[model samples]
Target: MTIRVLIVDDSKTMQAVLRARLSREADIEVVATAGNAAEARQLMRELDPDVVTLDIEMPGMNGLDFLEKIMRLRPTPVIVVSSAAQAGTESAARALALGAVDCYAKADRFGAMGTEDNGKLASLIRQAAQIRFDQRAPSIPKVSVKTQKSIGGDTRLIAIGSSTGGVEALQILLRDFPADCPPTMIVQHINVNFAAAVARRLDSICKAKVLLAEPDMPIRRGQVYFAPGGDRHMMLGGTENWFVKLRQGDLVSGHRPSVDALFRSIAPKIRGHVVGVLMTGMGSDGARGLLEMAQAGATTIAQNEASCTVFGMPRAAIELGAAGVVAPLDRIAEHALSRAA
Candidate 1:
């Protein structure tokens, strides 16, 4: 089946460029283009495109506001396409929090354009079209937390991995934890430009300190580390207390920051002291690694289908018999705390 797409950008040049880029794929059809949110709303009603590629800095109604409206009214899968500049980073992050399924950086400005962009764009379109749209619910503002308790001295480590719809899923799961939550490491599949923005956004919503993980950095309690670099897999290293270690390796299961790679490494290193959680995301990047963690006696949990944005990763883990318990996104934090407690 052809994947229908709608391009929503204020710039006529950008719309043309995106159309040209996406046109190369035989399975993709650019059904319509809208210069602003008002036009987008009308086309959305008329064209009924399978997916939408949205730009953040549109005139009049901005992308974030429009996205919020779409999530509330239409509930379609959206891929945020934005500039890599600082302001674009902030807006793109907000769009993701508002319920965009994925995000991509525009390639023309960087002067490193390639077929890879076309391939990725096409893949995103196909993936978005397959997403169960009505399953999406409106995003609620993050709740405020009064105080956070640091993980107890006996708590060893926390590891997580996600892809596809993971950006919003991770935010919701992390928002409820106390500031002193376990020393957590996350491997979220995302483009390089958006990784920092994701970390910053999570830091604002969660009580625990959140920052992009760097090689050789010491892991500290009450801090959460994210793999900022997407081309490498993040692992734990060091003698006294394991810290973040980034390494370039073959793409295992089609992802660089493969959840399996991180979880497999943590299984033997942290062993019984670790808590491993697999949230909503597409594909099976973390299934086998989660199983390895379960074998090593670490507590393993999968987000149940009811709360998952995409049920692929968690379902794969459950099928592999990796998860010790399958709980909804709202209950994951309390469950993790219980294991650590």
Candidate 2:
């Protein structure tokens, strides 16, 4: 099936470059191109493309504002094409939080001529086109009192691993966690800037304090530490009582902040005193680690396929016999809380 794409950029040259790069992929068809948000909206209604390539900087209506509107009105998978500057990173991070599917940094030299390096652009377009879009409307699930509970003495930690659609799924799960929740560590497959933003966003939503994980930091209860992506693996270290380690290591399973790394560490360190949750993501990044946790007698839960944006990670865990339970997204928080209690 052809993946229909709409390109929205202020630069005519960028539009041409993107069109040319994507045209090489037989599965991708550039249905329309818009130079601005207004034109993009009009074309969106007319063309109804499967995906959109959006530029961060634009006149009249910026990409961020347009992204918000698109998510609220007509949800479509959006790949942000941004520069490599600091400002670009910040904007791209915000775009991810606003529900952009993915982001690609344009080549540094491309800024001078307003043209992209076709090679890199084509690679990104291929990846973006393969991403499965979640069209579910945004609505906060009603908070249930039954879903919130205190952690048990045996359940000393909560570890979560996710990728792809994990950003939105994590937001929903974290928002429901209580202030006194167990010490939680998350390994989300995402860009570096977006990882920090995700932690901050979770901090705002959940009562628990959320911060990016640092090397040799003490693991404190009721706090959440997020693993930052950029060629590093978050591990467990320090003394048994206050131990937590975030170390830089080789990429495992093609991911730096791999869920497998985190889960394996927890299995040997925390053992039976942990609760593991695997959420929606595109790949099998967490399956092996989750199995380690399960073998260690830790409680492991996989998000049900019906609620997952992409069932790859969780499905792998289930197939491996690593999951103790497979629950819907809305029920995952409650399940974790219950195990803790």
Candidate 3:
């Protein structure tokens, strides 16, 4: 099915560029474009597009305000467009909290690398379009490396990868963790610019300290590190003394700070000392990596579909025979802790 999309941004240039970019897709169609909430509201009613790419810094009613109204009334899948700025970061956070499916970050001047930028934009548009309209917030609801023996003795490291419904899932999973929980790290697919915001948000609610992963940062027990979501992958080193090393380069498993990168990194370094969890997401980014972790003697789990907002990632892992156990979102924490400790 062709995915119909509406573009809502104050800038005509951005609108034109987005239009040209989205036009590159064979399945995504630009149903309409609007400059303000008023126009967008009208177009939304008339066009009934499957998805909407909304700019948070709009003229009249801001994107957050309109997003609230849309969620309450229209309920279309909305991906927010934000600038690569501090304000944009905050706004993107607010947009996500308000139920925006995802966010897109644009450089200050949108045309520095027009063609390349558009290609990225085209990918976002296509992904945004694939989100099913029935997908809703439930309020906190890989690798072919090997098959290892059931080596169990207190999990030393825990790594998780998620997307789509990850923020809420992480919140639910981490809230109950005691201060002495195993050193943990997560790669949640989100806008690169908003990674810090998410870390801060999670820090406020988690019993464990949640901080953004830094280069050469030591992995400490009871503290959770989040992968910075931009151009780098978070890697693990050191067998006895664990540390995080952020590497900037190509996207691994289709993401920087990818779950696969984090998982596979730890596999060879610390056998039987890790537990990997692949949760809700839209693709197969972490499947093979999780397999590597499991085969290296680490316990691995995939969140079950019943509790997942989107079952893509977990499903993929299960399909690849990667997960040692499949569990519901709520039960995952308990299962991990039991296996880890």
Candidate 4:
């Protein structure tokens, strides 16, 4: 099916450029373009496009405000198209929390992104088009610190992998963690520019202290580490004393900081002492590695399809027989904590 899209940007040039770029895709059709929220709102009501590509910066009503209105009122799938500056700001993180499927960072001022970037955007648009907001699970009550079971001494580490809807998923999962949760590491596929902003956002909502992982940083309880998005892959390192190790490498499983790399790195070293979670994402990056982790006797979990924003990664893992437990998004944290306990 052709994916119908609405482009909402203040600049006519950007709208034209996006139109031209997307026109190259055979299965995507730009149904309409809107200069601002007012135009977009009206066009949305009439056209009812399958997806909306939105810009964060707009004149009358900002893209974020408009996005909030859309999600609250209409619930169409939205993807935020942001400049470099906007991508690095908290506004980008807020866009994800507000229900945008993904954030596409513009390459330059004129929106002259390369062919590969355009293809990525096309793929994202296709995924976003498939989203059904009505299928979303109800919010889960967070397990209070006082009620959580004591962390078993045998469970020393927790590692998580996510992409696509991960910014929101991570926030929800981490909110259930106690202040003194186990040593945890996360690899969420994201733009390098938005990594720090996402970390700050997660830090604010979570009870555990979240930090961008650094080379040789020792993993410790009560602290959560995120692989800072860039050229290097974050690995669980050291023989006896586990620490973060960043290694330069080509893209593995179509990602530089690949989830497979992180999961495979820890599988042999930590064995049953670790809990590995593969959450919502678009590809099979973590499937094989998750299988290896399960083979190494680690407790493994995957987010259930019904609750996933995009069920690709977890579906792949489940098919590979890697996930020992497949739980809904809201119950994932509870299962992880229970297995650890």
Work out the TM-score per prediction: 0.93, 0.87, 0.84, 0.92
How does model 4 score by TM-score? 0.92
What range of 10 consecutive residues in model 4 has the weakest lDDT sum?
A: 138-147
Candidate 2 lDDT, tens digit per residue, 126-158?
555565556332435556587664446456889
**Which segments of model 4 are wrong by more than 4 Å?**
86-88, 109-118, 144-147
**Tens digits of lDDT, candidate 1, 88-129:** 887887888887888877775665545446477778778788
How many pairs of residues collide in model 2? 1
Off by over 4 Å in 1: 112-118, 136-153
Model 4's number of clashes is: 0
| lDDT value, candidate 2, whole model | 0.80
Best by TM-score, which number? Answer: 1
**Ten consecutive residues with minimal summed lDDT in candidate 2?**
109-118
Model 2 spans > 4 angstroms off: 20-26, 88-90, 107-139
After the best TM-score superposition of candidate 1, give how far the Cα of residue 254 lies from its true spot, in angstroms. Answer: 0.8
Model 2 TM-score on a 0 to 1 scale = 0.87
**Candidate 3 wrongly placed segments (more than 4 Å):** 24-26, 59-61, 72-74, 108-116, 133-154, 271-273
Q: How much lDDT does candidate 4 score?
A: 0.86
Better of 2 and 3 by TM-score: 2
How accurate locally, in lDDT, is each candidate? 0.83, 0.80, 0.79, 0.86
Q: Residue 312 of model 2: what lDDT? A: 84
Candidate 3 residue lDDT tens string, 83-197:
8777668778767766677877766344252534636666665666666546544434210111112212366888999987677678777876666778898999987779898
